[model samples]
Target: MVDSESVKSSYPKSITTSAQDDRGSMEKKQSVQQRVDSFESGEVETVIDKNIEKSALKKMDLVISPIIGFLYLMAFLDRSNIGNASVAGMSDSLKLYNERFNVAISIFYVLYILVETPSVILVKYVRPSRMLAFISLAWSIVVLSSGFVSSYGGLIITRLILGLLEGCLFPALSLYLTTVYSREEQCQRLSYLFCASGLAGAFGGLFAYALEQVHVGNMAGWQWIYIVEGLISFIGVPLSLFLLPDNIEKSWFLNPQERQVARLRNEANLRYLGQQKFDWQEVRKSFKDPKIYVSAVSQFCADMVLYGFSSFLPTIVKDLGFTGLQSNYMTIPVYVSGVLAFLVVAYASDRTKIRSPFLISASLVSAVGYVILIASNSNAAKFTACFIVAIGCYIGPGMNLGWLNNNVAGHYKRATAIGIQQTIANSSGIIAGQIYQSKSAPRYILGHSFTLGCVLVGLIGYIVLLFSLRYANNKRDERCARGMFDPTLTGDYADDFRYFL
Candidate 1:
């Protein structure tokens, strides 16, 4: 016993728990507390919860991304199926003489533009899930009714209604994503959802191919397209209503602990952004910001290419000497390629935390694609160029949306800004639909050239916006150094906030 006691007195135990570890933990808590104190002081109302676990992030993505993606897939299919219908003899059946087909396409955007802002603003008034479900049902009914349209005038009326409903989807989705995710997480999540457009294109091609083979009852192939797509959308309405959460705190799928984690994450974010309640002042502030208009113009330029290609790719391929079936088949490869490029660009943008470079690169790729389209006579070369155009046009706009969202803050202000952006950008649909006239078959040289010029203009705008963001950031840094910054500023107005260029 005396020997054992002597040995123990001579030995020292290893230190697994140290005072330093406790100090570190306490310091972290203190840091969070300090930030909370600042938030309470009303300097900014947003908070950041560094303690949010990886599992929580995974759960959020799982819950939100796929649902939005699926919804968008259906919406895009319903909207752009008219393109498939065009080559399926819709024009001849409806006696759509001259550019009346184009006029029908153009008319959709008129109502889309008019309703874009109100639809997005409505998301704030009602729950997002309910609003989305109601709109989806409404649009699906309109789409189903489109099959019954016997005349060009009827088609025009259906399209007008379709556009008005569809206008709610994109900008509302954009704003909804902002509510559940942090700024850095948005682009990738958006891309995850945005890949649906390409999927819709691919799926639409197959659907079109199958419908063209059917001749059931009085319905033609184009009518079948609308009927089938509408039915599919109708099936999704209930699912969306059930699955889409109003916000993180209200998510039915998440357990209480996960809900608490989500609430913490969102609360911290709200505090950091300095936003708690809706303010009409923020809405007024957005209109005065030059960045809003610049982003809108930039979107307009990119969409000129997007709507141009999306609205007419099937017809373009058909005009290149392929059968209608073959044209539909050809679209598969283009859209698949575009989806791959879109995912790659989105991932890279999120990883690098840069937006404009990808957008500019995409624009350049599309510009080159358009040049080849205009210059080439070989069908094979033109087909390859179509792939390039698909990649560029689809990918650029994906990032552009994230870029615009990144630059704005506050719930209502962000919604208003996105609404305005969509309103202006969708006008390109009208422009795109009209430009690719039937008279310009085989090689739509004017249409290709116009799209090319638009992409170039967008490229220049991206460059200018890049420099402008950098300039603003530099000025902010200077003001911070001089102690001239407003202490009570929050969100985009906060000195700590910088635009992602």
Candidate 2:
């Protein structure tokens, strides 16, 4: 379905600079040439109108964001619905006693964490539209199969396979968006993606509540949860294959002029669209970068709260003395609060071009919520604390992701960094699964206290990362002022490239 000829025809043969141009103009030309040399495609630059670029951007937002968001929603719903299933009697049906349930939950992350980096690296060769859609379809089948599982061992096998299939999605989606949106524009779009998880949390609750009422044949309510959610997720597979474009060149939604604008936008950020080859050096560079490690640490801390909270919210609520059905519907409001808070913060992040302040604030706010949950015994106070925790839970992880996306430049480097960051961050899922044990029900003092510590630690990591990025920017500025900066330097190493702090 990709228009291969359109890729060739989109750019003109070449653009030549006058030999008689001024010294500054020639230096600029030399800089551009150096950057072009670093890529394999050696594409020529093209002039584009700002108005046309804006129009193209708006079209991209309309066409691309919604589909990916919906797919993520399904992915999250399938994964976190286990919490709902556990509460709805899967625990009893499968004889998931003692640590069996926790093991099933933790097993998903094992393959998930291992496949992330490699799966992201595969996106370039397989293409986004095909890769994303195919994996989604595959996982949907696993989810459908999950409904038929009758034992603890069978449940664990499905979780493992589901983890492998779904692991390809998030990192791939994150990397794909970088190709579409400019650095300053990415956070808002990413907010839409992360917001899907919040929506999933909300929608999953509603679905669980409704499905619990069904008494068809002898099937448990938990089985229906997986079966229905799996069928719903199948809707996205066809939409992704037919509607999503591989890259700007293959974007059927844009006119020829608009395609040029898309390419120009990427070029403006020193991203040579579809030009870069897979480079081992870039992958190695990602590992060497201190920013990647710090960001990974922050992501880990944030995800500890995210995965733990999402997976255990129903249980936590049920322990608050509510019926199982009451617990499912009650968690809906908490997720809605998270989505609202994320939208407000994401808009401000894009407008001001800042990330750390909001990231730190979200972490601190969630810490306070955890404190309230640990210290207070009142049901109303504890429920309010859940809302407070939700407010910051979604924000921290999303902002951290956007922060990393903004700072990294080269395609391979960004891909590797995203994979690495996510791999490390998602390992927290293992810890999250174990922290909220059945023995620690009601108050869940251990889980609450542990998450509180994670929030504060994540806050400190953000502060350190902010200062580190600012310092890098300052160092680049100093080099530029001293005339020691290399005009030929590309990607994040370029003198003009500044980190988003």
Candidate 3:
């Protein structure tokens, strides 16, 4: 076993300790340095017992995953419940005629797209716990205020504010998960987060159906939908502030030994640590990286379907001859299908360590669903097509995110790429709102055909990305074999780094 002094001495004098060292004691520094040296020497498993690492990871799964998942559930609920409200009569109450309601829906994405990149960049500067918690609280207030809106103009303003606040969430949480979990562990954890959208859809439909029966004062059922869901999100604020740790080193739930193991796991996974200062070069690198653009195209196409489908599901169901309450209940099964499908796909992706195949498969599955929806006149067939469409809805976006997060390295670079990817992808929400306008309802041939085309486009993008990443990896391997690689290169640029294909 390596002793503490020798372990501390092994690190070069030029290698600076983390910023946390200033606040931590000498003993803490020694412990951390010892683990770092062990990782560098490829003896980390010997230094930190495997059981301890497993315990630490299991603990993170228990604490972090559920809290973030619940927050995302609320976020998705508030965002998509507008669809339920429209069906529940917010449109008539607020005099939303013709394309007015579509404008209200599209307006949210304008701010959402503008703020995603900046909000993710801020996650490095801000404590994630504080940032996420504060954003959740702020959006909850916006959601609550939405319940009281007396006019379309009032609703628009509330949606704008909600967009700005909620924009920070997905990217921030994605980045935060990267900080805590290894690359191999990421997809399953992210599925939990992404699956929350499906759960929110399920719960929102159930809630909307139940709330529609309420006769509280003069408040409509649509108003109660927003009020009740908004109030539930307030629970996340305290949960985040108290239970969520800023990073592995600062984790309140782990013991001293488990913290060391967690740090070692992060190092083994090639995750950048303690280097939170923003770098302009990394930001520039993200823009120049061809993979970001490819991933953006894929994400954009997937989100177009995601936003269009989720936002208008109730309307789609209602057009099938169901009453408002029946439409709300019918949406529950569709969302549950998405949640289950995503969980299975995510597990298989993680186990196989292959993302592109699953992503390609998802696009194909959803495309077939859209084809059925567009051609079928039978309501039963159309409803079955809804289930088929949902199977790949969460899988494509969830795996796309995990793929990007897996490939990118360095904190700021990854943050920038995620922001860029999400920004471009989320703009699809604008198109989603317009294409599914009231004029296109009943059959919604325009919307279904458009979404079908998106799925195919996204499929082609993923295939291109797969070949490009494979080519890049081969080039890197050739350079390493010839000893032409730079020893000083780190992060994803390192000669030893191989993209997960």
User: Which candidate ranks first by TM-score, i.e. highest?
Assistant: 2
- Cα lDDT of model 3 overall? 0.82
- Candidates in order: C-alpha RMSD to true structure: 9.1, 5.8, 6.7
Candidates' lDDT values, in order?
A: 0.78, 0.83, 0.82
For residues 1-501, what per-residue lDDT tens digits would candidate 3 score against the true structure? Answer: 523211111111112356654655875656555544443442223245767767788898999999999999899888888877887899999999888888888899889989999899899688898998899889988999899999999999998999888889999999999888767778999999878878887777778778777779999989998998889999999998889999886699999988987766655554343256788888888889889999999899999988878755776787787885676678888988898999998999888778999998888889888888899888888889889999999999899999999888888999999999999999998899888876666788998888888899899999998898889777765664444546576656765456777
In terms of lDDT, the poorest run of 10 residues in model 2 is 4-13
Provide TM-scores for the models: 0.87, 0.89, 0.89
Residue 340 displacement in candidate 3 (angstroms): 0.9
lDDT of 2 by residue, 288-392 (tens): 988899899999999999987875577667767787567667888889899899989999998888999999889989998999989998878888888999999
Prediction 1 global C-alpha lDDT: 0.78
> Where is model 2 more than 4 Å wrong at Cα?
1-50, 271-275, 319-321, 487-489
**Candidate 2, position 276, lDDT:** 69
The backbone clash count of each candidate, in order, is 10, 0, 0
Among these predictions, the greatest lDDT belongs to 2
TM match of model 1 to true structure: 0.87
Q: List the residue pairs that clash in candidate 3.
A: none
The alpha-carbon lDDT assigned to residue 83 of candidate 3 equals 75
